[model samples]
Target chain A: MTDNKYAFFIGCLIPYRELAYEISARRIAKKLGIKLITMPDANCCGLPIDPVNHEMSIALAARNLCIAEDMGLNIITLCNGCFATLTKTNKQLKKDRELRQRVNKYLADISLEFKGSIEVKHFIEILAEDVGIEKLSELVTKPFNDLKVAEHYGCHFLRPHKYLETENPENPTVLTKLIELTGATVVDYLDESECCGGTVLGIDPNIPLSLARDKLKNIKEAGAEAIITICPNCHMIYDLNQPRIEKTFSETYGLPVLHYPQLLGLAMGITPEELALDELRVKADKVLSRLVEEIKVKH
Target chain B: MSNEVKTYRKPLRIDPEFKNLVLKMPGGETLKICFQCGTCTSSCPIAQIIDTYRPNQLMRLAQFGLKDKVLSSKTIWLCAACATCVDRCPQGVEMASVLRVLKNLAVKEGCVPRVFKDFGSAILKTGFVYNIPKTRTKKREDAGLPPLSKTKIEDIKKLAEKTGFIDTIKGEESDDRQ
Candidate 1:
């Protein structure tokens, strides 16, 4: 907990819907020599607060940060929602001394304190920082081998202006870099950061479908092999809703959607099954089979 | 001679187009500092897929009184939540999170689209989403996969709801259901 390894905060989204995102992430991080230390009693990021328990949500997110702080470790998260919640809440406690006192007072009984010492980093940030890109590049047992990948930055990662992440918030190149390490190519999509329509799609399926259609059209026009993503929410929309979007828009979008971790797992030479190939809605049969066989050949 | 002064530019009552609920996350929201910069638009990937969807423009619209317009726009529903626009925006308008606030707002307002009704039913009736469509089950049986029964689907939905998953969208994860 003394900052040597990270306290893994597997946000709600991945566990509930985006399972592969976390599974592949765990597998890849293990391979990279970074240990994802987990907290047994980790609570919500309190992102669901503001709308529910405003004060309690603030305290809940702070509690998670404090749990990491107590262990003397930095909290690392994969989902953008978790990242925003943990980071912003931590930022809040630090900026407002009064709020910090109240939050600490609330947690006094739970034996947690927030002296603004705990650090929160996104999974991508840890990959870039702890596991040097150079080393990640070296471990490319299986290069993507010219696979065309379109990088998708989900809303939580890119928006709200304040989450100036470890990775370049704008013109992010790390996900692309990870893909490139596998000897694959990254394609530029005009709407890479555009909202996959957020949970708005949950209420009005049409809105997200059109947005996905717009995303697919650009990806298709770009002649990409797959759409790669990092956020679970974004991944959910793209993976679950893409087929419906295709039917509605009258466009044939067969592009397979991938989580960032899956792409890294492939480059690390893991088998397709290990990366949870079944999770992808638009199956990457060629992409998966080719990567698997290529890894076997290379090794 | 006294001249009467006339002003067509009325005092800015709430411009719904420009009306966005600024979520001041105890961190003094820097998102409000954005000044119509298009750096985010130039870099957004989803922007190319769906024309008329721009993070920067959406941010600007939220500033106007276009609450309904912003919430119901095809753009908000489609944001993939990639940090690309936030990364590219010169003004630091994390329009991404701003849109999330709008999304949460949509849920609160219950202003969901009809197709989106599927999500509501999924939430109210089942905690988990039904992936295999009824029409597609027959096709799956043709592929040698076992047929998905209506009873099995209902059971799954019942279990998810029982587990309080449906409540998660009523905006919850706790047993309290508050």
Candidate 2:
């Protein structure tokens, strides 16, 4: 129940596709003194199958909430999809008695119930709200003042403002502010609030590729050294699929996409190997080399 | 002998009760308030790239009780559910949720996409959507991470069955005649 402790809800995509996010998040959490208990029994946040059955999605999210409630701790998710689904379902189930009864009926079969006791949050929220920028700045032993990076605040993180209510969906500042905490300049780019189109990549690959291409094009044009992201799905679209987008569009955008934790971990003086920076698809050598050269000159 | 002209097209059938049914769904309450301002379409990231998928047009179709057209269109599956439209809509229509309702109805009509079926089957067998490979699970330990918590599959299956998710995924409720 302590503010620093959380039940880490490692959603499906992180384990299957984006281990770098999980690795760096863990490394940074350790350095920050935050305790992350793993929710091994957590199921998918129910977003992937939401189109087939809405009520089922609610039920699945409620089951995970029940687990967190049982542990008597709040939940922290690495993926925006999970954050959105669990937070929204938690809020809805708490407010709507009828909906709660319906979802609880499904939970009853599994011997679980949605008590609506705990809250769900994304990692960014934890750092911004609980850890605070002031304290985070003090931990930055090696600031990236020389680096400039653009941020992708994947849609689910802030949209459906009624459900999330975290920030302005149209012009969110949380990710940009968090990026600045690393002492890196947050470059302004066109369509900064656009969705990375990761959700529909399963349905039609071409459309998401086009959407990601536009984002990369804008960021490259804006003169950002790299693109920073928080969501694993967004990371997959921009980082893992960057080369594919380059090929499909006949464009060269060798932009390195860093998970926010990797960026923050570097500033916190965590080694690249520990943060798993090499695991990234697009090489971050340009950014890392600049940091090394800066340190060498300083010494 | 060549004077005979032939035309083949089924007359459009509008179901008056379709709108009510949609309204009864969780996210479909605001269906009647949409004035067709085209804001949702313009706000949509997917619609910008794909001219064929327009949220406003879908809203109009649903409003007109074009149940078959609204449910059967491939464009309904194209929504990323980013909810940009939901935030921007002056009517407060919750376009993403409305689209989800349409998608659910489409699946009920046996129009489930191949990928969703794979995701559903994966969740049924494993708790996660994409099955975490054994090598990756082993790699977690090497990376100084704890082993992933094992899911109680029996509990998950019981919940899935209670929610009728099993029937939906199995397509048992689908009318084969369609």
Candidate 3:
């Protein structure tokens, strides 16, 4: 277990924008005794450009993969888009020699090569698989025993079975299992497999915002104190867009969103400041205070 | 009741050549396999929210070679690429991938929406779709986090050049040019 190391692929979103996810992820990984060395010069996961140029997307992802292979460690990504891109790239390179040859030629010029040796895992996968649920619960000094949290397993975490095969695409219980380990009740909502609709925000924002609102309405109605997600894009859509959704629909649903790592960090007795919980757009103050009071009573 | 004769007209123009063009893309090879099952359309969240975004109709338009209509329609850009349709499609049609191919063609023909162009140009320049602003850096620093590492711009630039990223942004057909 001490030798468990991964080249942390801190994709463009987490490093530059989402500091709370970054901080909490780091804190949790440290607490769990996992070594996450930053991959040097890790570029974008090449998702934004995927729709524009498929070859370029593969090539860019190949470049990142080559960086990790050079270091002889598997890659772990925090963002779902990055997880999909890197995992897809690895799978594609392993199966298609011609595509690998073409991408390798581009990398050859830059003194890099895609040897297809290393693997890619999302942080959620690492937590769930490497850290078993029972062991994870043992590390929880403060649990959300009374909290009702809804798990938003974003689309990429399970779909496109050709590339990723972590859980059942239709009825994924892996996220639920992880949430339950925190001693919180996992609430089910309608359209659990529904896309967060953030991907088309550029095309027509109304639809994505509306989709977010509907999801929030369902989660609130299900009596969830907070929403938890693993992907940054999903977090942005649910947590960052809640106020906009409320304003658009003229409703007051103050549902706080938590990254799975943030929740895990809280359960590990990490201070809210260390987890950067205060940075969330939809405040988690009430939920955090409730958990804190529960811990105080136990003490 | 009086009976009035209704005239149904066929599609005025069909560009089978455009369909052939899309078929050459990596994931576009399965375009003709779609049987108009409507599974994709029904499964698409965006299609449910927006009346105009019907994946089944888009497939039919492509099959009918309605190149101009399909390429220029807001429907192609509206796909979230969530792969729900791809997973649900009975024929294994990669609907989202086909949409991407259409989007590429749209960009080549100068039919790209402003949002896509802005997003594309940002990646072309910064190797990232979004760049961190100064205020964001200050906030992170004040919170005691180290400054975000600067990307190796040249390495990314080289990869971008090889991929014809610049040409894609310029709306040129990079595949044939290379």
Q: Which structure among the candidates has the greatest lDDT? A: 2
lDDT of 2 by residue, B1-178 (tens): 0011112145656999999999999999988899999999898899899877888888888988979877877788889999989999998998899889988888888887777777888988888889888999887878988888888899888877887788778874322212
Q: What is the TM-score of each candidate against the true structure?
A: 0.68, 0.95, 0.92
Q: What lDDT would candidate 1 get against the real structure?
A: 0.63
Higher-scoring candidate on TM-score, 2 or 3: 2
Candidate with the larger lDDT of 2 and 3: 2
After TM-score superposition, the amount by which residue A264's alpha carbon in candidate 3 deviates from its true location, in angstroms, is 1.3
TM-scores for chain B, in order? 0.55, 0.90, 0.82
**Which ten-residue region of model 2 chain B has the weakest summed lDDT?**
B1-10
- How large is the interface RMSD of candidate 2? 2.0
TM-score of chain A, model number 3: 0.95
lDDT of 2: 0.87
> Model 1 chain A — which ten-residue stretch has the worst lDDT?
A48-57
Residue B65 of model 2 has an lDDT of 94
Share of reference contacts kept by candidate 3: 0.63
Candidate DockQ values, in order, are 0.12, 0.62, 0.47
User: What is the per-residue lDDT of model 2 for residues A13-131, given as tens digits with 9 covering 90 to 100?
Assistant: 99898999999999989988999999869898999999998878988899999999999999999999999999999999999999999988888878898998999989999999889
**Which number leads on DockQ?**
2
Q: Which model, 1 or 3, shows the larger TM-score?
A: 3
How would the candidate models be sorted by DockQ, starting from the highest?
2, 3, 1
